[model samples]
Each structure stands twice: as structure tokens, then as C-alpha cells.
Target: MNLFVEGFAWIFDPANYSGGQGWIVRLLEQLAYTFGATAIALLIAVPLGYLVGHTGRGRDLAVSFSGGFRALPSLGVLILLGLGLGIGFKAPLLTFVIIAIPPILAGAYAGFEAVDRKTIDAARAVGMTEWQVVTRVEIPLGLPLLIGGIRSSLLQVVATATLAAYVSGGALGVFIFDAFATRNYPEALGASILVTALALVLEGIFALLQKLVVPRGVVAKELKDVRQRSSRPLAAAGVPAQEGK
Candidate 1:
């Protein structure tokens, strides 16, 4: 459609968007808010997640609570908090923090659970203190999953922070809302595209992080062992596995 084309064209117009008087500020501000909220959420969620996951007590309760919190609508919570707290960055930031908690908590819990029981038992049997077992044994094992939770939380925060615009908190959503109101199709499309691009960038960074943290050698070794086992029956039956140099 010509209308859509024109709109996208305006978005790329550096002259119009020059002097940074346009969506750039909103994007940065929203990114800041989202990151800040996620930071706070991580502060609270990561430790609690580690503790609950390690102890195995109250984990179900935490999981249920985090799930409930995550399910709460961002706009609805923002509106209520903004209205109740007199509308500003504080309420929106808090609302985003709530949105960010669940994934990190869930991830952390999963990480803790993934630590090998036999490894834990061995640590205990070797006269390791509870603190040593957790710090030296459990946390290291859970780092991959814990990092996963942080990544999830980061992505969720980035997406939801757009809702800040609804309360005059100003974010990319503001541009989208303005475009919708004035029928400025270009701005709306542009804003959406930019937001999506930002999300993708965040996801890409986290993917690299996961690869860096998870030992590929371990995975490769495991796969090799599995293949060896599967070939054992064949080898016993006079079929040899391929030899490696």
C-alpha cells in the first residue's frame, strides 16, 4: 500500500529525525527503564531463585507467585500504578520489574535443580560445608540456566517497557500511540519495526552468551558416548564402528 510505504519512508528520513528530537530519545529512555527494572528484578530474583532452588523448599510457592506476577498485564498494572502513585517513571519502572521477575526466577530454579545429585552428595561426603557445596558445586553447575533466566528477563523487560508511554512515561510506544491517533501510519510501523529490531539484537547477544557459557566440548563428548553405546550392540554382532584418526 502507498500509505504504508510513505510511512516507512518517513521513519528513515534523517532530516526529520535529526537533532534527536524524535523516537531516538524515547527508545533510549525506554531501554534505560527496561534495563533498570530488569536489574532490580535480577537483584531480587537471582538470589532468591538460587536459595529456593538449592534448598528445594518453597520453590513451588515461588514458582506459583512468579507465574502469577508475570501474567499480570503490563498496561493494566502501569495504569493502576501510575494513577495510584501519581504517574511518572517510578510506577512504570516498578511495573516492568514485576514483568521481568518470573522468567529469571524460573530459570534460576531450573538451574539449581539441574545440578547433579551425586555431585552434591560427593561434595558433602568430602567434608565440604553447606556453603562450600552451594558456592563451589551447585552455583557453577547452575550458571548456564541462571544466565538463561537473566536473558529471558531482559527480553521481557525490553518488550514491556513500551507500555510506559501510556502513562506519559515516554517510550517507543508513545510514537506508536501518536501515530495510531493521528493516522500517521509511517511512525507506527517504524516504531514497531525498531522495537522488534531491538528485541532481536538482545536475543542475539544472549544466544552468544549461552554458547560461551555452555561447554560445547561436554555436549560433543556426551553425543560421542551415546553413539558409542548405540554402536556397541552392532559391534558385538560383527559390525564395527568407524575408526577415528
Candidate 2:
């Protein structure tokens, strides 16, 4: 309790708000690192993932790569890269990009896979070109899952960006690591709180984005499922089910 109180107090203190080393500045740096990494990862992963999902070629390879990438340890990779590249933005950026790729890739391919085969067949039957089918049918229907992947990747990137400080890339982790080294518990805790808060904020924002981007039919189907699930309990208890007019 005292630790949390002290941490919150430290965060709100006016003295901590000004310098280049300020929490706000560190937060912005962290956001830049996270966003930059995610954008690059999306550019690389999404297109390939979509291509694999659309063509059904190279899928096994993509799946293998996604699994392999996820199994890697971000910290170990960062350290190895730093040793090889010798401590610069390159190491941290590579580390962040590597960590962010798998989920986005998986999401893109899996999203397409999740679309009904019949729907895809129908699109083809309608004389749509392969490109048109992918863009018009698969992409729209698979959007929810695609965004889900982006959400997962974004969250992972945000959390992993803290490792940037290890390479002197400058982020909120600096506060935590620096304070901890000096035994400044309040500052360390405060930095931790800020990181957690930032992650949550990003999560909420992405969740809203996911909701907004999902196709209307998908949203309707989800709502219908929710309604049915809610009515199941009433049916189990022998209550009369209400019918929609």
C-alpha cells in the first residue's frame, strides 16, 4: 500500500515533469520505438501472411516461421544483437521488430483461413478476379482477425520496448532500471506504474479500433451469439424463452 502510494506520489510530483529525463519524454520515446517497430512488422508480416492465406501456398513455411519467431527470447536476442552490433538503435529496433512479427503474421493468415470456404467459392463463382476476391471478400471478412493480430502485436511491442533501455535506446525502462540500480524504490515503482498504465491505454485504444474495423455482418453475428448464450441459462431453468418481434 505504502509502495503504491509513494509511487503514485512520485509520478504526480511536479519536479519529475520537466527535464529531458522526464517521465513524459521517456514515454514519448517509448511510443516512438513501439510504433516504429509495429509499423515495420506489419508491413513485412501482413502482406506475406495475406498472400499465404489467399494463395494457400507457402502456408506451411509461414506457420513454421511464425512459431519459430514466437519461441525466440526477446531479451537474449537484444543482448546478442548488441554484442554484435555494439549498442545502438539498430539492436533495440531489430529486437522490437522481431518480437512484433509473429502475432501479426499469424493473425493475417489465420484471419483469412477463418473465412468460410463457401463464401470464397461464391466470390469466385461471381466472376470476380483473384485480386478482387481477396480484396473484396477475404479482406473485409477477415478484418476482425487481422486487427486482432495487430492488437496482439501492438501490445507485445509496447511491453518489449522497455528492453530498449537496456541498449541505451532511451525509454521508460530507464527510470525503472536507473532507479533500481540506485535503490530508489519509489522512482522504480512509479516508472513501473506508468508503463502499466501506458500498456492498458494502448490495449483499450486497439480494442476500440478492432471493434470499429470489424465488418457489420461479423459484429451482428457476434451479437447474435451473445444473445443466444444469454438466453441459454433461462432455457436451462425451464423459463419460457422470449421471442423477438
Candidate 3:
């Protein structure tokens, strides 16, 4: 379409790259919101997730809560918060964090559940303290799943951060909003393209992270048997598995 062509053209325009609100500036602001929200969510979710996973209590409750949390529309929450709190980073950051919690929570509990019970019993049989077993055996084996949750959370947070422009300003979403408000279709398309590309870049980064955390050899072994396991966590959780690896 003409809009796509024109949008690409607009993206490369040298004049658009120099201002304080330029692409790089906007991109950085989005990243800041993303990291801030995710960091906060990690603090809240990781411990809760780990506890629920390690103790095996309240998993049903956690799953139910996460499902509900995921249903909260980020932009809607941002608007409501923005109206009440006024234009500021607080509202947007809180909104992003709210949307970031679910996947991380899911990943945490699921990671623990993904581990073979026999492995855990074996560790306990060897006279390892509960803390030692958790730290030495379960945590390492479950880490990939926990990181997978973070990866999913980051993806959600980054995408939601774009809506930050709706409540405040300084993110790439600002361009799209400004362009549409003035009927600048090409610029709007360009801004949307930029946002999509940013998400893709981040997705690739996390994908590499998932791969790096687990050993390739172990991952290779699990990859062959993933289909055979009924309760196996998704590969997005990471590669090296505990069953045999």
C-alpha cells in the first residue's frame, strides 16, 4: 500500500531524527517504562511465584488471579489512572506493571510443576535440607521456566508501554497519537511500524537469553522428548530440562 511505502520513507527522513522527541528518544523512553514496570512486577511476582511453586499451596488461587490480571486492558487502565492521578509517569508505570504480572506468575508456578517429582524426592532422600533442595535442585531446574515468564512479561510490558503515550508522553506511541490527531496517515503508519519493530527487537533479545541460560546439549535431549511429556512446560520456558538432562 501507499501508506506502507510512505511510512518507510518517513522513517528515514533525516529531519525526523534530530529533535528531542526523535525516534531514538522515544524508543529509549519506551524502554525505560518497560524496564521499570518489569522490575517492579518482578519484585512482586517472582517471590509470590516462587513461593506458590515451591510450597505447592495456592496454585489454583495463583492461576485464577493471573487469569484475571491478564484480562485487564492496559490502555483502559492507563486512561482511568491518568484521569485520577493526572499526567505523570506514575500512572503509566503502574499500569504497565499491572499487565506484566500474570505471565511471570504463570511461568513461575508452571516451572516448578514442570520438574519431575521423583527428582525432588531423590534430593530429599540424600539428606538435603528443604532449603538446600530448593536452591540446589529445584531452582536451577526451574529457572528456565521462571525466565520464560519474565520474557513473556517483558513482551507484554513493552507493548503496553506504548500505551504510555496515551496517559502521558515521551514514548514512541506519542508519534502515532500526534499523527492521527492531525490526520497524518503516513506518519501514523510509520510510528506503528516503529513500535512493531521495537517489539520484534526485544523479542529476539529475550529469545537469545532463553537459549543462553540452558545447556545446548541438554536442551537437544529434551527437544526430542518434549512431545512425549503430557505436562511439560512450553519450550518458551527454556531448553535444558531436568527429567534426564
Compute each candidate's TM-score over C-alphas: 0.85, 0.88, 0.89
TM-score of 2: 0.88
lDDT of 3 by residue, 1-245 (tens): 97799999889897765579788788899999898989998899888888899999999999889887766777789999999888978899888888888888888788777778998999999999999987887777777788888998898888878778887756888888899799999888888898899899999999999989965643774588766764347454775456753
Model 2: per-residue lDDT, tens digit, 164-245? Answer: 8888888898988899789999999999999999999999999998888888897886676554356777888998779982
Measured by lDDT, the strongest candidate is 2
Q: Comparing candidate 1 with candidate 3, which one achieves the higher lDDT? A: 3
lDDT of 3: 0.84
**Please, what is the whole-model Cα lDDT of each candidate in the order they appear?**
0.81, 0.88, 0.84
The 10 consecutive residues of candidate 2 with the worst lDDT sum are 221-230
**What's the C-alpha lDDT at position 102 in model 1?**
87
Ranking by lDDT: 2, 3, 1
User: In model 3, what are the clashing residue pairs, if there are any?
Assistant: none
